[model samples]
Target: MTRPLRVVAAMSGGVDSAVAAARAKEAGHDVTGVHLALSRNPASYRTGARGCCTIEDANDARRAADVIGIPFYVWDLSDRFHEDVVEDFMGEYAAGRTPNPCLRCNEKIKFAAVLDRALALGFDAVATGHYARLRTGDDGLVELHRAIDGGKDQSYVLGVLDQAQLRHSLFPLGDTPKPEVRREAAARGLLVADKPDSHDICFVADGDNAGWLREKLGDRAPNQGGAIVDESGEVLGRHQGTYAFTIGQRKGLRLGRPAPDGRPRFVLDIEPVSGTVTVGPREHLAVDGLTGIRPRWCGTVPGTLDGPGVTVQLRAHGEEHRAVVRVTGEKSAQTVEIDLLDPAYGIAPGQAAVVYDGGRVVGSATISATRRAAVSAR
Candidate 1:
């Protein structure tokens, strides 16, 4: 019989993590639950609320651990969270870029910081409730694959994991659907069996990041006012802050004049330096190619410029578009180019472009540029 492995499961006090701990225990592994303390705000907690990393969440994790018959602890990582996740989120927004804080949390907090801490504490592997799977390839290499529940697959957000991290991570819930997870939690008598899934940014419990940023960066919001123009450079209206908008946004631009064709205008670009919010028809947002930097691969695939064709996801919950990936530069400093099979809309710089071969994740990178083909004149 194989010996039981000591596993540290990151519990967010949600049904997923609670069931994950129970599943690990059922698999005969020695399990421990750890909840991250991600924020310093005292009012961040609501009784029986479904926000990750809150005091209430920590207590719920403790209760789940009790049911699973394992030890549990709360790790105070607020300082690092502030530095890596929160600060970056604010900086990206201020620069007129939409940032994915969950991706940052997965990269810095869960995989890097918490994994290091777990290893130092004598655990053989760290587990999470993420809806993704890790498997050993025929070549004895670790590979990341999409979870069985396609609707809940979180591989896009986790595409930043490197080979080393993938080797020591376990996602026991990947093969199970969310409904079954809840059933398992109930069968195990876990208190979080019916807990609502936490959807808002865990640290920003109130989902008021712009409001929070307004408070933290009072009067520091970019004020370089510029024209909101159309494709022909005709000024449509004025905008207060370009940082408040993102690519492909349609509403909130109080343009006084109607379009010549009576169509709604969408945000085409946000120029931070000039503080301009460019608006145009929806077709202007489509792009055919994307270039990104600092690529990270989870499997043993060679990190080279030329590769077989793969599918790329440009945003969370976005459709997977067929593409060809090419890497450039030395391993230490690399850039990736992805030529899409079909034009993708709302391709934004600073967003992640995760590549996949069918269900298996190939790698991912931060988008640096997006190129669109010029439409031929009729």
Candidate 2:
């Protein structure tokens, strides 16, 4: 028999969240539905099922709570979201790095801010629809794991959660598939059962990330225009802004002339200060290792790891790479060094490297530097 708990359901007004809230209630827990108001001007975000934290989504959440027969409320975290997620996103781009805002939101907003408030309000736990699983490890600590539905597993983004956050978190949809979740939602009379999943960056309504950055970054942009150079230091083209490009970007280079060999060129490096975008062959983009900073462990942090079971995910929904991970420095200054057994291409700094021990999530870190593969293009 399971003990009933007073849970706060972080409803995003989507099918998964609504279903999660209902399931928490059905499990004999005292559940309260709360929708996070992330944007101050919700109208600026996407309106339909393609967006999240919008005005329509809030209304949908309220209606879902009604159907679930639970008390509902909305919490305004707009300022926090803007500072921690939005501002950080702009900063990362301006610094010539590709960051995952969804991962940051999970770390800073969803789990940190919301969970803190829930605990202060006397809630025993916070429930959400994130497709990840929680399990008791041999050491008796809670471990984060990949969901049964691999296609929908979100453990990579959630790798930021620490031991305390995992303790009071509940993912009710981990064992079920997406189709089953929607079907269950319909059976529960939830109106958002068939709503399409939100895609792209929610704040970027038009899905034009570069254009949006240009509009918002105004004075903060590194340069209005800069030279695009090749390996030989030849100025191949010019770019409007360094923020518009990322490492491994293949298309949109619009180089005035093709390479002498006629092979395709890819963005190999970006120097924000100099506003220099470096283009090269695809083979030059391979990286054999990376150093990650600000490592966030799900449970206890390991000092050193070198085993066949150890794997690392460099991007969300990306395939894992066998790695030898080493933890260095103390607490706040700690860094993770990962040596990938297989060279990976298009890996960028500011991306997260979620380390896993088989199906269990050990931790995650923000990639700060990478060591290029020694091999040259044939």
**Best candidate, TM-score:** 2
Q: Which pairs clash inside model 1?
A: 305-327
Model 1 CA lDDT for position 275: 78
Residue 19's lDDT in candidate 2: 95
Q: How accurate is candidate 2 locally (lDDT)?
A: 0.92
Best by lDDT: 2
The residue ranges of model 1 lying beyond 4 angstroms of the native Cα positions read 42-51, 224-226, 301-309, 376-378
Question: Candidates' lDDT values, in order?
Answer: 0.82, 0.92
Q: What's the true lDDT of residue 188 in model 1?
A: 86
lDDT (tens digit, per residue) of candidate 1 on 1-378: 347889999988888888877778788999888888887763446633535666677788888888888898988999999999988987887788878888888899999999999899899888888999888899888889999999999999999999889877889989998899888888889878888887766666666665566666556777635689988888989876666677888877889988898988998888887878888878878899999887888875454433454689988788988887878788888889888877898777788999998788988888888897576554
lDDT of 2 by residue, 1-378 (tens): 479999999999899999999999999999999999999789734555455778888999999999999999999999999999999999999999999999999999999999999999999999999999999888899999999999999999999999999999999999999999999999998989989898888888767789989999988987887999999999988989988998899988899788999999999999999999999998999898999999999989898888778999987888999999999999989999999998899998999999999999999999999999997536
lDDT score for residue 194 of model 2: 89
